[model samples]
Target: MPENILVIGGGPAGLHAANELAELGVSVSLVERDAFIGGNPKKFKYKFLFPDLQPAENVIGELIKKAESNKNIRIYYSSEVTDFKENGKKFDVTIKSPKGTETKTFNSVIVATGFEHFDPATDSKYSYQLFDDVIDIKDLEKMMGEGNFNRPSNGKPPRNVAIILCVGSRDRHVGNQYCSRVCCTVSVKQAIELKEHFPEMEVYIFYMDIRTYGFYEDLYWKAMEEHDVQIVKGRVAEITSGPDNTVICKGEDTLLRGPFEIPFDMVVLASGMEGGPQSPEMSKKLGIELDEHGFLKPANITLSPFKSNKDGIFLAGACTGPKAIVDAIVEGGAAAMNAYIYAKKNAQ
Candidate 1:
């Protein structure tokens, strides 16, 4: 019999890992909580990705296509690992799907459960959901995906828009101190897209620090230089109703050492990512370690981020921590290689 492997989550990392493992002559069982694959990128209906501004469909669609076509892979849609038990060097797993419950044994397991977008509505400061015009990055992304870019309140084109970065990140009050790696770049990308769509409209980015690290800085520069997107260096303390059916951003200009209240037709909160409920659920079910920041803790952060605490189990993608899509795909390949080596070596 062939070496069988179980892959949880049908997101980018899981899809990539399952495909790679299947190609390596391994019989892989992929379980996704969603009825369909593609993860949050699909659920949110992302239009374009940052850095290069490429169509999200180009990447996510391809991964889904590959995984669906692979002969060595069996995908259990809308399913979950209800029970997991270590069987010596191998394991016995029970999968519960819409159809029914089934149990299987596997040589190794790869967990690629992805992260969730922070809900800006929980913060209260951003006034998300309270004001129809006050939305988050994911909300804007969904709008763009549907080819509808207008103020949610009145269904009209916004005259001026404010894109606030680090909405749910790097804030002690929110209990999320770590920086979400892609929010800055993603905000910049959205700013550029807004400018391209409506050249007459004004775009302003309010951020404590524009952290477009590495090559992603180019998009930031482009948003400023090419598109003339104004950036204000201060965090908005509160968002409240303003005159003329607009929202007021009340905060201090740290650069000039003064307070100001600016009104905008629309406000887009660049909310960060979180480990979500799945992190703790997976930790309890799989008996893995969850870090202080709510993500799954790897065996070694530096030496091996893909390896989990338990033997024959691996971690990959945003489930471990906040990361870009490119990084998740790379980690998927790495985890697939490690899992294959272990499964082959310990074959029954």
Candidate 2:
């Protein structure tokens, strides 16, 4: 009999895992909470991550096509795993969908729920909800996708835009100490996109340190030399709205050791990434362990990138930790291999 496997969360991680296992002749079922298969990557219009500025829709569309064409793969959208129980050598899983709740048996499972943006409402200085013009990087991406770049208060293009990096990350006060690896790149990407759209607009990024390691470092240099984006080495202290629908950004210049305020037509908080909202519930259901930072703890970092504490469970992508798209895909494939080996061993 073909080994039965369940891959949860239908993002790049889940999808890639399922595809890889299915290629090895394993019966794989992928469940996603959203109506669509692609996760956050589907939410963007275009991803400008250096070398190539490709449309996210196209990338996800291709992945979805490949998954659909695979014979050993089964996909369920608008479905969520509600319960998980170990019975003998198999896992009895319960999933809730629009139709109803259903139970299935699987030899192994892979959790790839991905991550969510950190909420900025905790910081009163950022004024996330109070100021209509103040928005997070994800929100700004959505707005740009909808062709709504102008401020809500006035239907005019922003003359000056400010991006504050590390809003909810690497800050002990807010309880999130781990550095979200992608914020710096995402900020630079958005800044370049903004410049491409509005050549005359002034774009400034306030950051403590620019982390563009590996090939991404070249992109940072491009943004600085070619795009001419203003990089400020400081942490933003507060953002105040002015009468003219402008925003006042106050932060101390670490290099100059002085305080300064720059009035901008719009302000964007480059929020950090965290585990999904349903992560806690899912972790509890599966009896999987989470680290102090709330991300899934892999069984062993050196030997296994996807194996979890549970015998038949695995993890991949942002659920394990922050990773780039290519890294997520690689981890997803590794998770699938782990699940395949478990299923084969149990079948024997």
- Which residue pairs does candidate 1 place in steric collision? none
Best by TM-score: 1
Residue 168 error, candidate 1, Å: 1.0
Give me the overall lDDT of model 2: 0.84
- Tens digits of per-residue lDDT, candidate 2, 60-161, equal 677777788999998888998888899877899998888888899999999998988888998677999888778888887877767677776586889989
> Which 10-residue window of candidate 1 scores lowest in summed lDDT?
171-180
lDDT per residue (tens digit) for residues 88-189 in model 1: 999999999999999998999999999999988889889898999999999999999999889999999999999999999998888889999999999999
In model 1, the runs with Cα more than 4 Å from the true position are: none
What's the lDDT for residue 303 in model 2?
86
Q: How far does residue 134 in candidate 1 sit from its true spot (Å)?
A: 0.2
Q: Count the backbone clashes (under 3 Å) in each candidate.
A: 0, 0
* Candidate 1: residue 258 Cα off by (Å): 0.7
Candidate 1: residue 191 Cα off by (Å): 0.4
